[model samples]
Target chain A: MEQNLQTNEEIEMQLWEYIDGSCPINDMQRISILIERNTLWKQKYDELSALHTSFSTNVELEQPSMRFTANVMDAVAATHVAPATKKYINKSIIRGIAAVFFVMLTAIFGYALFSVHPTTGTTSMLPKLDTSKFNLSHVINSETIMIIVAINIVIGLVFLDSILRRKKEQQAVKP
Target chain B: MELDDTAVIQMVLQGQQAAYATLVTRYQQYVFTLVMRYVNNREQAEELAQDVFVKAYRYLADFKGNSKFSTWLYTIVNSTCLSHLRKRKDETILLEEEKMVSISDSNQAERPSDKMEQRTQKQMLENALKHLPESEAQALTLFYQGEQSVEEIGVIMGMTTSNVKVKLFRARQKMKDILQSRFSRELNL
Candidate 1:
């Protein structure tokens, strides 16, 4: 009795696969023979066949309103559809980052120039530090320093402007 | 000649945003129907479907094209509907375990003619689907209406193909069982 019940469920499952066209050709042929000869198999096959046909062909699908495509397109446009891609790289953010890096580099270079003192008489087995060819005045002049500072400030301001604009844009998108 | 989904995607990515209308039209019925199975309301389902398309557009670049576009689309549909369902689970839909199939009879063996049987089964199947768990109902719809293969369903539902097959089998079996029980009960009444 238990085996009969299992066989019914299993037969139904195989018929489901066979009707779905998921069964291999060999299994299809085998199941076809069983349906042709066996009354139990034929009865189950008839019932499942109808259900499968109805599911695939006769089942009524829900249709959207006429404005579905238009509404979806409008929503797509209104939303910020651009993904986080390199193509949308912000120039202002790049400039800001460059300014910050330049400021750090200039500070380090200036500090190194000051740190190198004139080690004159304290010479050992190690070669004495040669400060003769160094042109400190030319490299660290007031005008050049001021120019670098000005460029840094301009880039920093542009970066700041972009960030503020982005914040406003984010706020606008929130609602 | 009509452009395929990949070509349409490339066009959209290249700044011709209007090209997305093609994909939207192609998949609107599918997306709308799948979401309707979850929300079960026309207005909310339409709204959810619209949001899904927009979300898909936003992340269109993430689609690698290695898989069928429909399979990828279903993944998005599943997530969108699941999240929305989570919010309304308490009020609207029952939990999976709570959805059960109760068969009242197993001995009635009278069968109808082929044509009439098909029609009756169609009606019975539609009614029986309402009594099933959402996963099974969806599996049936995806297999029948969406014409999705069990393998593709596995990818979408994050299950193995065998597991998906079991779900499909159980779903069909339960629907048939529900109809039989209904038939037996009506005869008794």
Candidate 2:
């Protein structure tokens, strides 16, 4: 009788866990004792079990709408708009052109430094005395470097003008 | 051919943006229903569901494959629901009180008829669930959803397995009393 009472109390305490099939093995054995000993409790448990089963099987499933997928895709597209193609082209193409110009200017300076020599001091006798200020060593060493730098400055100004013009055109065209 | 969740996640991490759409399509309904259980409003549920997907996309890189993808997704859903509840502090209490009052009023004025009794019972159960403590309501719903093991639920809710068992017991009793009383009261038994 005492054992039966203990089983009944255990069953009441762990009834939901038993119904869920989540009761541990030891608890299961104990609850099974109560089930066998008391037919009323077993009947009540079975009815409740069936009720839960009925609820699960009969629960309504909700589908958003036929347009749900399309709506989501539309929202995604609307949010992350693709920037204009001309903007991309202006960015990469202009930067590439500028980079090429700078590299070419550097190469010209290098050639002047290593490959060209200054005219001899035989020309120093002329009245064009700019040559008086320039020695062959200094002229040969510095002329190419200075000319290459000047070319780079001019190229930089030209590149800046083109970039500004392109940006202005883009802004102007956007109505 | 269909790829598994792990494969889809890997593809997404490799910068395959389209793979994300597949993940969303597969789990959107499940995620939406889970959100609906919390917010209980269809439109708000939809918005929260979309927000959850966007968040999952953003944090897909951090999903380390330690758990199933669904578990990770559920963690995100649970957090999103909790955050929403926190933001609208009185909204939950108001919904519960509304449900309780409606149930009480319907009980007093209306005769218990046979034809719509099942519908009334279901409504009563839902109302009772709305009136449950937030933790108990969530625990019971997650249990019935059948997506996770008791251990997994305990992990999700940061409760002990025994504590989850006890809470579920209370929730079921509450449901049982509500359902039984609805029938008995209607028939004047």
TM-score, per-candidate, Cα-based: 0.66, 0.61
**To one decimal place, how large is model 2's interface RMSD in Å?**
16.2
Residue-pair clash count for candidate 1: 0
Q: lDDT tens digits, residues B1-189, model 2? A: 999999998887776767777877888877776777687788888888887877777677677665668767877888898899889977554555666576567556554454336655446456556656666676766666636665555656666566777787766665665556555553222
The list of candidate 1 runs beyond 4 A from truth reads A84-175, B101-124, B183-189
lDDT of 1 at A78: 78
Give every collision pair in model 1: none
For the second chain, the TM-scores of the candidates in order are: 0.82, 0.78
Task: For model 1, report the TM-score of its A chain.
Answer: 0.45
| Candidate 2: stretches off by over 4 Å | A1-10, A71-175, B95-111, B118-134, B183-189
Q: State the lDDT of candidate 2 residue by residue for A58-147, as single tens digits.
A: 334445655565656555543432333454567777899999999999987776555533664333223334656657785556778889
Give each model's whole-structure lDDT. 0.78, 0.67
